[model samples]
Target: IANDNPYKYQRRLASITSATVAELDVAIPDPGLTTAVAVTVSDPIDVENGAMFSVFQAACDHEFAKLIRHKDLRRYHSWYQMKLREALMADQRDETIQNGYMQDSDEWGLPLGEVEY
Candidate 1:
């Protein structure tokens, strides 16, 4: 059920991801851990939240870089252009913050995907 709470989305998304990741066996070339060991060390790097958030950050970084390099909207002088610039800046800030969150979570042994490409 879709809860009307804004926070529910984040939590629901995490739960879905955990379910999916839980189903996937460790992607190791060889199996070594027994069920007990797996339960203790299993991580979510290959899961939904980590991968999803990583992708978001990567895309944001790419777009921000492109904007800074190209300055494609430089020629414009309109309300729309102003809004675009503001939105892009905000997105960059958000991406940075998300990155920090992911890093901290990963440090705590929550699998946040590899450093985004």
Candidate 2:
């Protein structure tokens, strides 16, 4: 799931992700512990432990580079664009005092949305 290639509507996350916080103990791979162990995407939790975030980061970095090099968004798959969008929105919303939106006009982004691309 961290690769941004979660596959077919995010189903790959089922083994590791959950809606309830109570189950997070085992469902979520602890970044510190899992980073050192030999892990795989097939692991019951986390593809790289916390290091998988780097995988996702690498994917994003690739898209960014592609955009810079070609001035286009057509090369990457829709899933890549969708995840990037979500990540951007989350980052925008995470700012404590200034999140790049004006209360008077700019609308705060939702955490999730229908893929529009």
Candidate 3:
């Protein structure tokens, strides 16, 4: 998943400044890598900063609810799904507004319809 969309997750480029060979061994426990001199770590997304995060969280909850057999949980899942959809729509609206403003700006030149042949 990280390979597919690297930009979606915030990546940090870090270098091991000072570490003994034994310390390096303990610090970089992932055996798959040959060296641990430098590493790129993906930080967790700030869910509170964007609507997309809430949408993703709600979707995950909805899917997880399917695995359990509970009446109230199912209801909660439905509510969450609805809220997610609303958030997605709101995000779309906001994007559209921003795009419209960008297009209207003199920096972008005349609007499409106002463009002279």
Write model 1 residue lDDT over 1-117, tens digit each, in one string: 233333211111123345435333334333553233323222435524443444444555546655677453332222233333344445555442343233333432322222222
Residue 2, candidate 1: alpha-carbon lDDT: 38
Model 2: per-residue Cα lDDT over 1-117, one tens digit each: 466443322123333344331122333344554323333345443443333454486567657856687544444434444454455455554443234322332332322222234
TM-score of 1: 0.20
Candidate 2 local Cα displacement, residue 26, angstroms: 30
Lowest-sum lDDT 10-residue window in model 1: 5-14
Deviation (Å) of 23 in candidate 2:
38
| TM-score for candidate 3, residues paired by index | 0.36
Best by lDDT: 3
Candidate 3 lDDT at 96 equals 27
Off by over 4 Å in 2: 1-76, 93-117
Deviation in Å, model 2, residue 116 alpha carbon: 16
The per-model lDDT (C-alpha) reads: 0.37, 0.42, 0.48
In candidate 2 the C-alpha lDDT for residue 74 amounts to: 47
